[model samples]
Target: MPTAATVPYKPANRCIYLHGFASSPRSRKAVYLKDRFAKTGIKLEIPDLNQGDFTHLTLTRQITQTAALFNNFNIPITLIGSSFGGLTSAWLAEKYTQVQKLILLAPAFGFPSSWFHKFPQAELKQWQESGYKDIYHYGKDKLLPLHYEFLRDGNQYDTNKLKRSLPTIIIHGKNDDVVPIEVSHQYISSHSTAKLIALDSDHGLNDVQEIIWQEIQDFC
Candidate 1:
């Protein structure tokens, strides 16, 4: 039998990365984090929430799908979620005690209430009546059809109130147009244990990749 000191080493922690809406494991941010963290003996798991079924993609369904993957971790895990994925991570962080920390990037929390106002009243009415509407997916480079049910699902998960005691770090851009910096501020205000890092970049935050990497490395 081999002595404990001579045994092969194993990483004690896991990293589960949840991608944003309409995005996949192939997203630039996901790949970048994977490459950076791999050198430290950490491999990230990025799940495809859509699972080849975009028609039924809702925030609730995505949460369920992501939870399944996260629940399998027997050791402590750090969750890194971006945009819509950030919202999903909130729900998981609230439910799973195995998660040690949450890192959210421009989380699209508190968005539904404001987004509904973006479309004209007539367009909104038509979408509601039609049951489904086409929306452009930047990650996929294709127009995806989403149902109104997604909004109904979004209403159920309030990121501000979920796991308010969980340790969290939020990285948000001051110039974010999609989710807005105010929302992230509000989230941090409500969650006493959460910290916010405000940057001058846009929602993409591509310009500050090195900074983000350093923060993550420090946190891990």
Candidate 2:
């Protein structure tokens, strides 16, 4: 992906692009989606989740912040989110009928247990004792501390409660290590309106942006 890109004029109907954990609004994917939408005269909102605060970083807080930004706009939205952002998007669509369409890119759903299990006993114990652990921040080019509360907050949300009414599509990497494709499958099993497209890729799925972008165009 390009290091940077330019965004043009805004449009009435907007789309929100929520980045993943330890990511930023300036991420390449975020800007790519922003620049792409700008060409179609559709606005994109990419908020700063960290915003100088990492002590209370969690899915609930992120979702609240995103909802606040989304509420400012009166128009309906096409919600697109990556990883943890995708999980947030799913929750938002469950509560708000204004979300006209929803698209998840390798969404991090049902990962509370998966997260805890991924780490060994010693590492998990360390994370619990310290209350936080440093993870790579792709935007800042360094390791940033993420509070353990992030996982705790994620666990509280039951994905099975998702409302099956809205039109939603999930694109997941079959080889995703962070969030498995089976999680998305579980999400799809609940809703007939939901569709899952499993691609032969990894967690990033950066290699198939063209195909995913085409699907996004077709979806809208």
Candidate 3:
């Protein structure tokens, strides 16, 4: 993480970077934003939110922490949340008036309620009793246990309510499996102020840093 300069200065624009679940502020996107904004003297704050166990903290706790972090800053804030962070950002933007701009990257539209619906109550109980240890393999990345429960809890935070008539940008990959691009389209269609940008990359969009930065610059 980059240290904030000690110079007594006010930023022209204030931005908050929210990393995905199980991810930290040291993520590539957070690092990229920090480096990009350093040259322009813009303040970008990325706070650590992972509390050891994902299931231990509730969604309200996450939202409260995020809101408190923003409350400490005295400037017009723009939130950029990726994946699970994106869902949290949407909730914050809807609840907070200081959030002037929002940028969501591959945000989950809804929870995996349908998939879990098929499981019997006994099976679900057994799964939960087993510590919810479900390993998910995504290419070379291995997701740990309790992630499914996190997603299940994440479903309670409704994304549809966050569709406000405010300046919003939804950047999603066309081939994103984690979060379908159609969700972005649906969000844009529902909100008149939202703009959807479709990219040819995957959910991470790790290869198109420059393009993402340019889009953010334009929107900001």
Candidate 4:
């Protein structure tokens, strides 16, 4: 319910940053933002959303937890969401008027339904019936259990309808195998207020950290 216009820009400068799924506030990007913005009085709000069994909650609940960070903050917010977090940012931006800008990095436009298709129908059905399944890998040894219904529910949110003409920057890796770069391109094509920056790396954009940071600074 906290609109962007009402959020106080205490210290008169700063922005909020959100981390991706299966990742904590201690992620590389989050740390980078915090360090980079500290000199400018810009604070980053990176919450931990991976404590419990993530697959048990619905996507709405997951999204709500992320959006709640903005509710009490008095400063102007510029949301930066990566991967699944990016999808969450789209929903938050649609509902909240307080978001000044949005930065999406290799965002999945929709759930990676195709990845599920690799499983046999019976296996997929069994996983769905169980309400949980290890769907993907996160980092080195982390396995991501996904709730199919949660993805189905999240897909209901139409990103196109949340048009606020807010400045949005999307940076995607050209060689991304997880969420194809084409998805970001399509999003930018449909949203007149959005811009796209393509990198030569993969989904993680691991090698181009400095360049990506530079782009973010320019946009903000």
Candidate 5:
């Protein structure tokens, strides 16, 4: 990943980059993309999705927070979201017409439900019964206590509800263990205006940032 100081500057275009779950604006991918956009003289607005409180994080909060950024612009803006943020972007685009374009990276299409199968039945039950579960926070480099309300809130969002069609591109890793590429495949099948670019990488997609950038350039 490129290590460069994030220089504050005026934005040449209306573009927002939303980081993944348990991540901050300073994530490697966020910083890398910020640097790339800076090189193009474009300032990418990255909001700290954590909101200084990851324990109480939920998808609804992410959507509400990100929506506030472009709500009053009264103009179309592009959105780039990764993982859980990607899911948030899709929901935002569905609800708000201001989101004109979307660039999703390994979007968590089927989330809380998909997660049910990943963990053991006993573990899932314990999480619900205990009211909280400890998840490894990538940005903090430690396990953090996440409230069970997160899962409860996520259940309200169904990927099947996404019916809005706009200029959208999804870049997903073929070997993604977190959110499977099949999810993107299913997503593309429904939306006629969306396309999928499967790459040879994992969930992080760090090794293929250049390729991702190139795709973004072409898409934009």
Candidate 6:
């Protein structure tokens, strides 16, 4: 139940909220955190990773676009990312010294490798041969065409390379079906600065949002 007004803040500190894949700036968590930050006159930057085109979305494109936001500002930043965005934030923190802290929710660590098992071998081969696959976009509320390049580009980023020791907090649902809580467990085990909080909820984590917010407040 922590609000931005209750949390200590510095005028120059920057905070950006990154939504999950197939989601947008208008996502439930993004909007809720933005509103809470606004209560204390803090601006939370929520950029649409889709960039007006979800068809050709890739992890590289998202990382480049999100990193561009740090161009002119020399101030320390706090990144809050959910699902795939959590993966993005981790890379951003690795590449940029300006990112002082991170709050990750249900981070998709093993990503495409983790997801590939969900589809049959023939289905996966068909997606590669067909060049694109139909995916359910939660933000658009429809099945959209996503190119196979998403998998190829994602393979370029190895989570093993994320060795920076920036303070990080990962809140993952114990009952998450999409990305296993074991991913966070492995991440926290390797990074001494990282902490994992297992919540009693599912993947979407709508029920434990307030607890997540409280964790974020304390971590920040």
lDDT by residue (1-220, candidate 1, tens digit) is 1111221223576788888888888888888888888887778888887788776788878878876765444566678999988888887777766666899999988757765877898998888899898988767889999888887777776665674456689999999988898988888877888899999989888888888899887766
- lDDT string, candidate 6, 26-142, tens digits: 888888889888886889999999999999999999989998887644467889999999999999888777788899999999887886888899998999999999999999999
Residue pair clashes in candidate 4: 4-97, 4-98, 8-74
Model 6 lDDT, residue 190, Cα: 93
Cα lDDT tens digits for candidate 2, 1-220: 1111222213355688888877788876787878887888767888888867865688889878877865533466778999988988888777665566899999988667778888898998999899988887877888878888888788888887786456788999999988989999987887888889999999887888877888898988
Q: lDDT of each prediction vs. the true structure?
A: 0.79, 0.80, 0.72, 0.72, 0.89, 0.87
Q: Residue 125 of model 4: what lDDT?
A: 82
Any runs in candidate 4 off by more than 4 Å, and if so which? Answer: 3-14, 72-74, 112-120, 135-140
Report how far residue 140 has shifted in candidate 2, in Å: 1.6
At residue 169, candidate 1 shows an lDDT of: 91
Clashing pairs in 1: none
Arranged by TM-score, best first: 6, 5, 1, 2, 4, 3
Which pairs clash inside model 3?
none
Best-fitting candidate, measured by lDDT?
5
Candidate 4: tens digits of C-alpha lDDT, residues 60-100: 77578866766554555677888878877777777776666
Give the worst 10-residue stretch by lDDT in candidate 4.
Answer: 5-14
Superposing every Cα of model 5 onto the true structure, what RMSD results?
6.9
Each prediction's RMSD to truth: 5.9, 7.0, 6.1, 2.9, 6.9, 5.5
Q: Which should have the higher TM-score, number 3 or number 4?
A: 4
lDDT of 5 by residue, 7-38 (tens): 12223347899999888888989999999999
Considering summed lDDT, which 10 consecutive residues are worst modelled in model 1? 1-10
Give residue 174's lDDT in candidate 4 (0 to 100): 89
- Model 3 ranges off by over 4 Å: 1-11, 55-57, 72-74, 112-125, 134-144, 147-152
Model 2 earns a TM-score of 0.89
What's the TM-score of each model vs. the native? Answer: 0.90, 0.89, 0.81, 0.84, 0.93, 0.93
